[model samples]
Target chain A: MTDEAFEQALINLTETMYRVCYAQLRQKADREDAVQEALKKAWEKRRLLRDESALKPWLVRILINECHNIQRKNRRVIPTEDVMPPPPPEDADGVMHDLILALPEKYRMPVLMIFMEGMNGTEVARALRIPPGTVHSRVHKARQILKSQWEEAQKE
Target chain B: MKQFPDDLSRAFGRADKEFVYQVQCTVKKLSEEKRKERTMNKKIPFGVVLFLAILLLAMGTAIALTIHNWKHIETAMDIAVENGAYWEWSLNAKIRLIEAMAEDGLAVSEGDMAALKGDDLTEDEKQELADRILTEQYGEEHFIYYYTIAVAEWGEPQTWTLEQRYWFFKTEREKGLYLDNSWIDLLPEETDLTRDEVVRIAREAVRSAYGMTDEEIESYAPNVSFFITDVCDTPRWMVEFYTQGEDGQIHGSPYSVLLTRDGEVTEDWENLGVLTPAQARLRQERQKETAVDVFTMRGQMRLQDQNTVFWNPEGGKHYHFLADCPMVNADKLPLKELPVWDAQFGLLTPCPCCVSLQDFWSLKDKLRYDVGSWKYPGPDWISEEEAVEKARAALEEEGCSPEGLYPAVYSTGALEEEDRYIVYFDALLTDPDGFTGVDPIYYAIVDACSGEVVSCGESESNG
Candidate 1:
């Protein structure tokens, strides 16, 4: 594709790519690194993109893969810590965001892809390379976990 | 948690202005990297290969045709040499001598030329046969083929074959079969000086005349022959040596030096004047244009002071205005200079300690400030109309008339390092004589912060 077209495509999906990276890699530096790495890979393999229509999904997949690679590398360096509980009521959205992050990795990925990245169940399935039914069940399980934690916090 | 707040978009929009700029820069870098990779991976096109093949075939055919048309005319027979021969003629010189003799009505044919062209006979033998043929037919004047030869062993008849030869004409402009006195060596009947003395004198003359070292003269193995000629009206020693020219071709020029009977060097022939003053100046200018800067492999930078700017050879990114900058290694004495404008164009910051101390402080400060302030536009910046207006004002300040002139303004975006927009203004100056063509007279880069022209220069082209 022409440089202008590739640039325009990146600009159009910048928000989606940013949200995916931010949701997976919480640190600002890590998020930026992931996005840059994904963009570089995409540029190197741009010739493999056959259809312009597939550009968004193709980019999202590369970004998600880059994020996972960074996470795997980070996991080896630091010991696993328990996921933090939801915060207080002054920041309700922040609380919900933390609770969603606290879910299992598989369910957390689908929830973030659906809510933050503005992707539907099938789109999330295509991006994650999983069955659409599996994505639906993961989103359901992720919400259940967040609800149980929210109710328990209310009692405390 | 009936509804997780859908403010994820707001959080996603937190990808700041800096992030966007960084992504753009990364994309630009990646694009350049890919372009380089593609260029490296590209193969020579088939059409270009085909064209080259056809061209070579055509050239080969032309050379073959020329060789086929070469006419064979005359030849001299091989001369026999005794067991102790000192000199012999080159094969090519023998052929040319025979051709010249045939042209002068000597009865030599293609068969004789063929017979002498064989490699079976020794060179001394060939020279004897050539001498006999010339003496019998055209007289001693026709014995024009002559060159100094070195025998491996004295007083021994070893088989010698001539591989390459040269044609010796009577004069540069004359084609007659004549060997000048300069080519022939007449052995001295009674010499006051020995061969070693004559050689020492010749070597000293060569060293003084040509500025060649003793080692270089020894490598040339100069051939010295003593002969008497009326040109100098005295006896002189002729010195000839093969020296490599600037073009990498070997050239041998004879230098004549007259010596008295006591071996005191008298007068030597002066060099023929070659390059005039104007030609020398032109050559110097050409060398300057093509010479590469030692600091940067690019063209030599010409400084504003008319001195070329050189950098430290010991390796530093900063270019120094002075060749002997303290930062430069003393052992690497001779630093290379580059064109000043090229250094500026390359965005190489000058060596602060070297350049700031000199009178070029203002120029250096201006370059550093202007280069640092220049920026590419981000997502939200100044409007194009504002950029154009600033550019127009900048051009007007540069003394361009707004009536006949038109300005082409380009917005290059905001500088990420500073809060300024980079706008380039190109003013098309209409010819005062009402000519059809538009000449770009002024190019200015203005900062959006203060609307001041950071850099301004005359444009080289209309666009």
Candidate 2:
């Protein structure tokens, strides 16, 4: 891709990247740093991206890896905030979204990629680097958990 | 659950606009930073324009005393190197260019060229020998003029390798996650066009296509190389101009064009880098013109299902055949068995990133990713220590001592973009008796997982 196209493509995905970074990282500063680092890597290694069709998942995969590196670095630090950036809302969709975010990261990312990010089983598998079947199983498990949570939210 | 996806998309879409803008800023900043870093020493630009003017200035010895003065061009190039117009390593690149130009003019055999590839002689000795060899073949006066033009052109390191030029096009055509790799090479028929005309056409194409100001051209150090592929009856001039990054790879989008002997650009020029208004209009014209990069909708990209080759569980715009999928097997990411043609596969819109080349022919072939895989195992690659140990053991196994050699460049699996840890070692050479420079002695590519040395090379210290 031309640097113009490459830059524009990355810009267009900023929202998705921000969401992915926010999903994985607790602090905004960490998210900012991770986002920049991932973009830098993607730019430096832009030639490596053989297929442009895979840019979204390919980039998300990079961001997730960056998040992993940050997590690895901050493994010992105690978290001051939970996964949900804000308190749960009253609406069913809002409540359900928070519940998804609250899911264990292994399960949470796949669910978000599939439902929120519109990534499919293979895409989630590629982005998360889990087996395709593994991605299915995790999404399956997360769905069951969300179904139960949705039912309970309806009751409330 | 029915409205869950829509709701989530809506909910997640509420992320801070500042966050999105900040990330955009980050991407822009990073691009600028990389471009700046690459051109850090390139403070003064205008190498090409100045040389072109100089060529015009040197009309003849009768009119201009400096017609014999190749010294001015040589002086200019020396000044460029000193001014950091070229990278430090470009000194090596400069000599390589001169040697290549000289070789082309001399028709040196393959055996001689292979011998010259080895770094057996000092820089000065190599320069002197190159001068002597070319001077003898093409008399002294002609040689000075020839060398002058070479020094001027050498400002932008000309890539002479046929493979390198073709690979530049091939790589651009095959963006890892973009289009299917279907390409047909249709060369414009050979002509009696002179080399000078080819270079001029290519330079103009690059300048116009990128909307590059003279300074931008100089800042980028647009390296243009022309090679007429004579393999077929239609031996056309392939002109490629690209900026070489620190990694010695194309840092910027390379623009190339195939010119008919008459100098008109074929459809080939339109698929490359940021296009100017004129080039964009050409894409508009390609509706009638049979251009190569027209990404026609073929089929849906699918994820693998049990028996169904690809049931379209997810939407992928591009498809790759499962054969030769070494990385996929290793990655455990099953290849989506795609249909020869299927409706289940979601709509294959013009994939945003697939803009370079939308070749659908190689859809049935395994997708090869060079850097990191789509899996992006860069951060999770084997640790540095493990990579070092692997390289160390391989070096010892090869009967090469690791003493005095330091691992200056250590890269793990995903960084290789392949599944190997690339460890390059360099030893500092002391010239108490003669000369000094760091010579890379030994290098190893170790498998990231198995710790096996995939390959290893050792260079005996020639000092």
Best by DockQ: 2
Write candidate 1's Cα lDDT for B1-463 as tens digits.
Answer: 3544444445334565555665777788767754542222223355644653464345444433432211111122112111011113355555565675556455776666656667767765665565555545433321221211111111011111111101111111122222132222233334456656776887787678767788966655444455433233244454444434344333333333445545666644321111233343343333333232111111123233444577654445456666665444567656677675442213233453344322122222323333222244445555545655666676667676444344434333232344443333322222443211223444555555556556554554411
Point out where model 1 deviates above 4 Å.
A75-92, A147-156, B1-8, B11-13, B35-463
TM-score of 2: 0.34
Q: TM-scores for all candidates?
A: 0.30, 0.34
TM-score of chain A of 1: 0.77
Error of 2 at B304 (Å): 53
True contacts kept of each: 0.16, 0.28
> Which window of ten consecutive residues has the lowest lDDT sum in model 2 chain A?
A75-84
* DockQ-derived CAPRI band for the predicted complex in model 1: incorrect
Question: What lDDT score is found at residue B206 in candidate 2?
Answer: 69
Taking the candidates in order, what DockQ does each have? 0.06, 0.11
True contacts kept of 2: 0.28
- Return the interface RMSD of model 2: 16.9
